[model samples]
Target: MTQREKAKQPIEADVVVVGGGPAGINAAIAAGRLGARTVLIERYGFVGGMSTAALVYPWMTFHTVEGKQVIGGIADELVRRLQAIGASPGHVRDTVGFVNTITPYHPEVYKTLAVDMLHEAGVKLIAHSFVDSVAMEGDRIAAVRLTSKSGRLEVRGKVFVDTSGDADLAYLSGAPTLQGRDEDGRTQPMTMKFRMRGVDLAKVKQYMLDNPDEFYRKTPIDELESLPLSGVMGFFKQWNAAQLPINRDQVLFFTGPEPDEVLVNTTRVQGLDGTDVEDLTEAEHLGRKQAQQVADFMIRELPGFERASLSQVGAQIGIRETRRIVGRYTLEAADVVEGRRFDDVIARSGYPIDIHDPSGKGVAASWVKGDGAYDIPYRCLLPQRVNNLLVGGRCISTSHEALATTRLTPSCMATGQAAGAAAALAAEQGLAPGELDVRLLQEALRAEGALLV
Candidate 1:
């Protein structure tokens, strides 16, 4: 049979989401709650993209620098559910230094919660499915071509949300897109997150308190010494004489649900574009190897981890950026640093511009002055030259600098929720996503408990 002849019966929905990460999860939930027939497709067998697949623990802070909760709605609901099940411990502030917003959780627990929550919201979840192509009827996406174990199949929808993180659907639909910075077409490094078990929390905490100089913290705030493992930023110098193969500085670890468990964020594979199949494959190998090297160094050099075991590796490497769709509006660095507000704002984010060096040499973080949050306009979600489609997650339109902050988990979820609701409403009104009344969309998001600036 020909490629077209092998096609199966179309799976129809009012809204179709092409990802199962934080953004895709919330998008489907929001769409389904509006009484729209929603379907969520994922590349993996399970949900929770970076969080579960990459073993990335904790949601980045949902608050502004002023300590006000800026990101709520579906994002907050997920955290609350995880906390209720002891999968997460809510949010913690790193007063020792940059006031990092951290909410630690279990990867498995996060995956479970996401799947259950999507099901409870009445969103159909299709796992291990990938969108290979798009069928465009004029400017609108008539159907999405997916290749899975069952072979070629198509999903038809009134509206489509591209939360693929890499803008897969948007790009496949011939939408204009850009990758990395304008300088070299290079993107941020990919990381492999791992966990350490049997960690001696008491011993580690005591050592951190005693050898505060070994670690770096700007101000000594409340609960300083109690933090099991804060930022010991300069521990990397110790590894220099020993000559570890790992790139970058510092051994960053966050406390897990149990005192004896901790999540480690230290592996980085630089100069790899996440969208390229060959590059992504190479990153997965190199990232995991780096993780093993880091783990061995930990047992040999660090305290509290003397008896710790390299318990688990992530399901996949954590991707920071890839193909960013060129949307109606491109958010600039000034928008983030100056805390610019938009008339059709969808979400608020306070994360600094954290750039992981493409050379695998180092990292640079520039904070937002006054610790304020900036707005993501509704236009950013509307991919340019596309009808009945929206882009969410890290793939949204933004300058490289602004993308550093807007791509956070909470920020992605916020955008996902907004895009989903807007798509559903667009379908209900029988209008294209680009033609729908944005003010009404904002009202719908506000009703869904999202905090729009």
Candidate 2:
């Protein structure tokens, strides 16, 4: 049921973080800042994972509905850096109220910024390298083998942080993992983001500023004007009237940092496993087809996009859910919907529970109560049977429902920062990550400016 390969040429680190998404970046930075010898491995040449590779712009839910900025630390640093370069427009409300406070940014610049921060933190980065396998010693992982054009190499670490969104390392290391919903193994549909240039934002705004009733985006609330998904329903109605074979009902668009460009998030591919190579390949092909088709549809049906051209397609399809590691504690849907708080919380989450239908039709969400947030406990990051291992991103222990919230970019940054700090402390004290003092870890996090309340 599997394949195998022999590993060679060992390298070592105090902490080894797999995957270079927001989580891995923060983890590496935290460990390095703590004076730990950290190594970060990424499959892509660039650092940003879904944010860059999948073109998933706009960091979401940086604050609670009550408008308290809950996430800080390296995540804040990134936002500030992007702000300094005028590549970010700052956090604002979601037009449709699907989430709160989405900070839209330039993908390429974000990648470069992440790399610069990582390097400045003294974290060694190995790009274009994929984790092949994990070497285990009883309940602990000894090292993980990586493959690249350079050749096969094994990286030994005192502690391992798995930020792979698909939970690749957790699955490989014999940690228990679950996929999708409990009733069935069906995951949320995957989306491929594409961009269009020569967009008339003024025209779109004028249309929205006039025909407010026909558009999906309602009027700006609380004096916060987010990037608009205007003229969505009206254009879909037009698509229907014109007998266009447009399969989607929602119009998801983000205003880019650069004028005249709009990022589109409408390509949805269902019935695919993000972790399976064959399924991923099929999804990619289907995604490409849809990107072209949608670009053509937008030009014909939507205003502002009348003269728009397909400028770029994301390098990879963005799969929202895959394998979720069964960790020491599993975050449940109720915990999020009810805004559960934990004494051991290392990160605060204000995001709602968003589940995109597996059939790729639409999305359903349930928000937290009283405009407050929930806490992600340290237990969720601790994978069962892996004492020295910590899961940092979407793969951290969560039910299919809870992963919907925890998988957001902001949550990933918080979890990643926590995992890296825990790993570094564990390595320094010669203790497993699970056995490290969480109180001390919290103090360290507070000292680093993480907003945990």
Candidate 3:
């Protein structure tokens, strides 16, 4: 390779998506299915970002307040296909609540399914590649420089979608972003999810119904000190204000094909900045150590976990909060509480305003009752000054309060699909994403099986 050849070579595509998780995968697939040459770049080798790589099983809130399926398109198809292959467990139709309408999948199985979906859609996948910087031409993004084992390279696109969850590309492109809340600007805590094997599922359930207190008292985990997992069990009651009642026998375990396995979602690593590489690196090490300790405590202290062993740890530490792009409109907490609707609403979310304490040990979630659900305006996904850039996933424009509700995977997928579709239309019409016709974009989204109301 000569000196001229060593210069960052540019690879062009119609749409270039950053991040290969649910949001990125759906975005790339949607764009490709729409006849756009899409290139998806991921830091890891897998396709499903959080769901697969982070081992975050069981996507939350895929339905509406009226018990109707709200998240459709590629999101619905991905779940259905995984279920057919025994990768995901079948959902209990209209179960106890809206959150229960969707099913949880095995993380490993989900990874396989996501890769298959991308392949079928003809999306060019470049895994193990990290997007380092954005190349701008005037007001629009011209290309993005990525670094991998093969060295530095550039991927140029007409329209760019920031699905990195951290909003790396968007921020590097000089887009204004809000991290966490305004008062102190503290990001939510990070978690390291792990799975345990040899759990006695029946005993776990019995313990929750029988001796909830005894379970909390015996478990050494800090989150179970007062408010524990048991508090989240009541059918209609909200566990937001009160402390979660601890599940002595791990009653909240996900029931997958492996009877002995139990997924643990409890490692709360706090005070670490997701944007800081040093902080993130420390958080990962600390999270893994804590996960092992929790696993050991399960076997030693908990009744049903006497023989339980650590099965697997999450590939990436689960980052709860990060950058919130300052878009044309920012969804506020008041909007969420009032269930505000917008004329240009692209999707709706009913999940509670769950603000995980910066302490990372416990959550400060507030539930909305009655018909309390908010519409996510299309503007929140579009940056104010940027012309061709769109943001999806956890980094969308929202107030500190509203970001919590919109951070979930299902909602992220919804925003990602819409953003991708909008980007494709903008490129095909030779217009900026912000200048694209809203009504036409909405119609296209609906036609592509997206649930937009």
Candidate 4:
């Protein structure tokens, strides 16, 4: 018939995962390896969503403040794989003192590894496809409508997972969702991360030594000479003196897989809605302008960047907050700070509540209690009113304060692995994802080396 009619024909799979970021990749791989015919759909030509597209380098805090490795499974697998290929140096101490460890990986290499692992697990990837709508059968999602270079198409699956970061699939399916903070509907500010090459680590370290009070309070001055400069989060004096137009309080940069290269994560685009195209466009423009100014300031003022040159700006702005599905259980600020444990724990994280003010000023942070991590319950992934749909990544149910920590990349991968295993198990049992036995799901994740205590 016509193109519209042709789009109605469905492509079948046991599990359908939307978004090809870290969460989606792990979800699809977990499902595929468990014998499900899994399909992964992404809007970009490559995977590694924020990692590659937004240039959010250095996966942070896979361990607790006590140096205990809390995040594992696919997240750990990805790091090990990168290390095997010499694309990453594995987990290193966080000199910035924001977290316990930061896993630095080559973003280009991550794209390749993600693709290779997905293929090895028998996952079918549909890149450059954006899902805009869904067909519902009662409370369950029957299919999702996708638009791409080839025009329109529909994907039908037994179970659906929304790892779209913004919970796009859940929103399209009419699931109840919450956006931004409770006081105001404003979300955390978006940032554009850029890279600089020819950075002199020795000079930067010496500067830190000479002006210890200018850096983060937790920065270990004595160890600077011995430890790698994995990350540095303070340049208070120079930043304040220069009076850059950017909204951030201090300079923050992370060392990389390359010795001479550093990723700058200091640009903050505040008071913008990440889901709105107009807001996103403005963020992109404003962020790039700030990036250029920041780079110039570094070259002129920062000791380590004397010869450094601006290398690359991210393909997209880094979105820290968006629409989170209102799931059966909403993770709260107390749960994170108190290190709450759940009987149905699927994932755990020790990252703190780090809220970059929506008004574009300072950050409010609170670490996990006494070097302990809090549990992420299975009910958090079960969106209310959606029968066969699951959610992973930063979009899973959580209060605005709690989102600051759960929005982290490593934790997103953990939740994703849980959702994928649950999806495959539910599909095989001919049941909705919520009806799947939490114990069995936990067992499956543990079998795959996931850490859920």
lDDT: which candidate is best?
4
Clashes of each: 0, 0, 6, 0
List runs of model 4 lying over 4 Å from the truth: 1-8
Of candidate 1, the 10-residue stretch with the lowest lDDT total is: 228-237
Could you estimate the TM-score for every candidate? 0.95, 0.94, 0.88, 0.98
Worst lDDT 10-window in candidate 3: 230-239
| Cα TM-score of candidate 2 | 0.94
For model 2, the run of ten residues with the poorest summed lDDT: 224-233
lDDT for predicted candidate 3 compared with the true structure = 0.76
What candidate 3 gets wrong by more than 4 Å, as runs, is 1-9, 93-98, 212-253, 369-372
Query: Candidate 3's residue-wise lDDT over 377-437, tens digit each?
Result: 9999898677889988889999888898899998899899988888888889989888888
Cand. 4 Cα-lDDT: 0.94
Candidate 1 — which residues are off by over 4 angstroms? 1-7, 219-222, 226-234
Query: Please, what's the RMSD in Å of model 2?
Result: 3.7
Candidate 4 per-residue lDDT, tens place, 387-439, comes to: 99999999999999999999999999999999999999999999999889999
Model 3 TM-score, all chains together:
0.88
Candidate 2 has an lDDT of 0.85
Candidate that scores best on TM-score: 4
Model 1 deviation from the true structure expressed as Cα RMSD, one decimal place: 2.5
